[model samples]
Target: MTNSPKPRARGADKRRRLMAAAAQVLHRQGVERTTIADIAQAADVPVGNVYYYFKTKDELVQAALAEHAGGLAEFTGELDKLPDPLDRLKAMVGAWVGQRETAARYGCPTGSLAVELDKRDDGGLDLEVGKVIRLLLDWVERQFRELGLPDPDDLAITFVGAYQGMSLLANALRDPEIMTREGNRLTRWLDDLPSAREDGG
Candidate 1:
C-alpha cells in the first residue's frame, strides 16, 4: 500500500504530537474532563485526524498512559548511573521534589491519572494505572535490594508511599515547599538507613 507522501512524512510527527498532547491534557485536566478535541487542539491537529490515530477517547487515554510508563522506565534507567544504590534512591526522590511547582499546580501526573481512572470504573484501565505505579515501586525496590536491605520490597513501599503521600499533600495545599521539605527529609532518612550489608547482609 502506497502511503500518501504528505501523510507519510507527518504521520509519525502527528502521532507523537497527539500522544504528548494527550498526556499533557490528561495530566492537567484529568481524563474525564479531557476530550479528543482538547488533545487535537493542544496538538494543533485537525479533529478528524485524532480518529484516524485513536479509535476512541479510551484508546487515546491508554496511549497517553503508555507514554508515562515509558518515561518512568527511562527515568529509572538513568538513575542507575549513580554509584551508590542509596544515592540512586535519593536522586529519584530529589527528582520528584525538583518538580515541586509543577506537581503542586497539577498534582502527580500518574497519581492523578490513577485516581481519575479508578473513579470511572472503566474496564481494565486500573491495570494501566497499576503498571505506572508498579514501575516506580519496582525501581525503588531494586535500589533497596542493591543496598542489601533484608526487606527490599517493604522498604521500597515505604519510599514510594511517602513520596505519593507528599505529592498528595503538596497538591492539596498547592505548596511546592512542602514537597521540598519532605524530599530533604527522605534523603536524610535514606542516608541513615543501615548499610545493606550492615542491616542484613
Candidate 2:
C-alpha cells in the first residue's frame, strides 16, 4: 500500500487561522469588543487553541496591532515615489486622512486599537502601539531629510502631529470635509515654509 502524504503540522495551521481571525475581529468590532471566544468562533477553532498561541487577550490584541502596523508600513512606501519634500509631506497627509475616512466607514482597526491602548498604563499593548506610532513618525522624518530640510525629525513630528490631530477631530465629528479643508490648509502652509521656498521658485 502506498504511504499517504504527510499532513501539514496542525499547530502551524491553527496559529495562522487564529491570527487571521483576530485581524478580522479587530477590524470589524474593535479590540474592546473582540473576546477570545469571538476569535475562536471566527477562526472555527477551539477556545483553547487561542490560549495555545497567546496567553492573554492582551497578547492577541498586540499581535493584531502588529499586523495592522505592518499594513501601514506598506502604505507608507508610496511616499517614497514623490521627489519633492513638500510634495512628499502633502502626499503623506492626504494618504493618512484618506485612510482615516476609509476606516471610519468600515472601522479603523489600527486607530481603534491605538485609542484603546492609550487608555491603559504600561503594558504590552501600549508598547506595540508606541512602536507603530514611532515607525510612522520616523517615516515622516525621513521624508523631510530626503527633501534637504534641517532637523528632519522635528519637522516630521510637527507635520505628523498636525495631521493626526486633524484626523481625530474629523473622525470625532463624523465629517470628511473637515479633513479635506485642513489637509489643503496644511499643504498650503507647508508650501510656504522657508525650506520649500529655498528649494526653488
- Give TM-scores for every candidate, taking all chains together and pairing residue i with residue i: 0.93, 0.75
Tens-digit lDDT track of model 1 for 161-191: 8888889899999999989999999989898
Give all candidates' CA lDDT scores: 0.88, 0.74
Candidate 1 has a TM-score of 0.93
Q: Write the per-residue lDDT of candidate 2 for residues 114-171, one digit (tens) a residue.
A: 7777787766677787788788889878877776677888988888777766666776
Best by TM-score: 1
Clashing pairs in 2: none
Best prediction by lDDT:
1
- Candidate 2 lDDT (Cα, whole model)? 0.74
